[model samples]
Target: MDGILVGNRLIDAGEYELAIDAFTRAALDQGLSADVLAGMGSANLGLGRVHTAERLLRDALEKDETSPEIWNNLGVALLEKGEIAEAEQVLKRAYALDNGQSDSIRDNLRLVLAKTENSVYDEPQEQDYKLIRRGSSDYMIRTISD
Candidate 1:
C-alpha cells in the first residue's frame, strides 16, 4: 500500500509515531500534498506536538484550502494549543465548507464554544461545569459547587 494510506491507517490505530514515519516517507517520495500534510499534522497532534501540527496543517491549508479535513485538523491543532478563538473560527469554516456534513467538525466547534462560554466566570462559585477530555473525546462535567 502507499505510504499515505499506511499513514492514515496507523493514525486510525493510534500509532502516531509510525504514522509520522509513514507520512514523512510519503512526503519525501511524492512531495507534500494536502492529504499527506494533514496526516502528518494529525499524527503530530495525536502525539501532543501542537506547534508542529499547527505548522504542518497550515501548510496543508495553503496547498488546498478547500479540504474540510485539513481545516478541521488545523482547528484541532489550534484547540490543542489553547488558541480557542482561532480554533472556533477555523472549525466553523470547516463546518461551512463541508456544508455541515461532518459531525466531527460540528462537535469540535461545540467544544470550543462550550469552553469559551464557560470560561467567562471570575470565580469557582460562578462556574458550573468544566470540560474534560476522556480518551479521544471531550466531555463537559459538572464541577462540585462551592
Candidate 2:
C-alpha cells in the first residue's frame, strides 16, 4: 500500500510520471490487485492518458466489479476523453454501487449535464451564508441571530 499512498500524493502534486511509476511498481509487486489496477488507472488519467486509464479500469472491473470509486474515476476519465455516453453509464454504475460514492460521480455528471442545460439558474437561493463581493473582502461570512 506504500506505493499506492505515495502515488496518490504524486498525483495530487501533478507529477503524473512519478505517480504512474509508483502505481506500476505497486501493481507489479502485488500482481493484479483490482485496487492496484484502479490506482494505475487514476494515475494514467491524471496524465491525460485516458485510453490507458479506460483499459486499466476495464481490466480492474473484470476482476472485481463492485468498487464504486473505480467506476466513478473511470467515468471521470471517460468524460475527459469526450466519451459522454460511456462516462454516463459508468457513473450510473458507480452510483448504484454505493450512495456515499455517488457525490463525486454526481458532480461529474452535473458538469457534463450542465453543457446541455437550457440555462443556468440566476443565483442560488439565499441562505444563512451567501457569498458576497465587498470593496475589500471576500469571505463566507455568516449572519448570527440573537
Candidate 3:
C-alpha cells in the first residue's frame, strides 16, 4: 500500500512519468489492484495518452465498478478523445456514484456540458497548433497562431 500511496502522491504532484513508475512497481510487488490501475490510468491521462488511459480505466472498472475515481478518470479520457456525449454521461455517472462529493468531477462535468453546448453551432475546424505546458506546478498555455 505504501507504493500505491506514493504513486497517488506523485500523480497529484503532476509527475506523471514518475507516478507511472511507482504504480508499475506497486503492480509488480503487490499485484494490480483497482487503486493501482486507476493511478496508472490517471498518470497516462496526465501524459495525454487518452486511449491507453481509457483502456486502463476500463480494466480498473471491471475489477471495481463502484469506484467513482475510476469512472471520473475514464470520463476524462473520453472527453479528451472528443467523445463529449459519452464523456458527459460517464462523468454524470461518476458524480452520481460519488454523491457529488468531488469538485473535480463536478468541474469536469461542467466543462463537458459547456463544450457540448458550444459545439452545437460551431462546425468542426482543423487546429493548426495546440497549447502545451512546461515545468511543474507553474505552467501556461500559449496559442501559436498561424
> Model 3, range 1-146, lDDT digits (tens) per residue?
58888877787677889999999999999888888888888788778888998998999988999887778778777877778899889888988997988766776677678768978988874433231322221111222461
For model 3, the local distance difference test gives: 0.74
Backbone clashes in model 3, listed as residue pairs: none
Candidate 1 has its poorest 10 consecutive residues by lDDT at 133-142
Candidate 1 local Cα displacement, residue 101, angstroms: 0.7
Clashing pairs in 1: none
**For each candidate, what TM-score against the reference?**
0.81, 0.71, 0.81
lDDT of 2: 0.64
CA lDDT of each candidate?
Answer: 0.74, 0.64, 0.74
Point out the worst 10-residue segment of candidate 2 by lDDT. Answer: 131-140
Off by over 4 Å in 3: 125-146
Tell me the tens digit of each residue's lDDT in model 1 across 8-108. 77877779899999999998999999888888887887777879988998998899999877787787777666677898898889889989876667777
**Model 2, runs deviating above 4 Å:** 100-102, 115-146
CA shift of 110, model 1, Å: 0.9
lDDT of 3 at 112: 71
What's the residue-level lDDT of 48 in candidate 1? 76
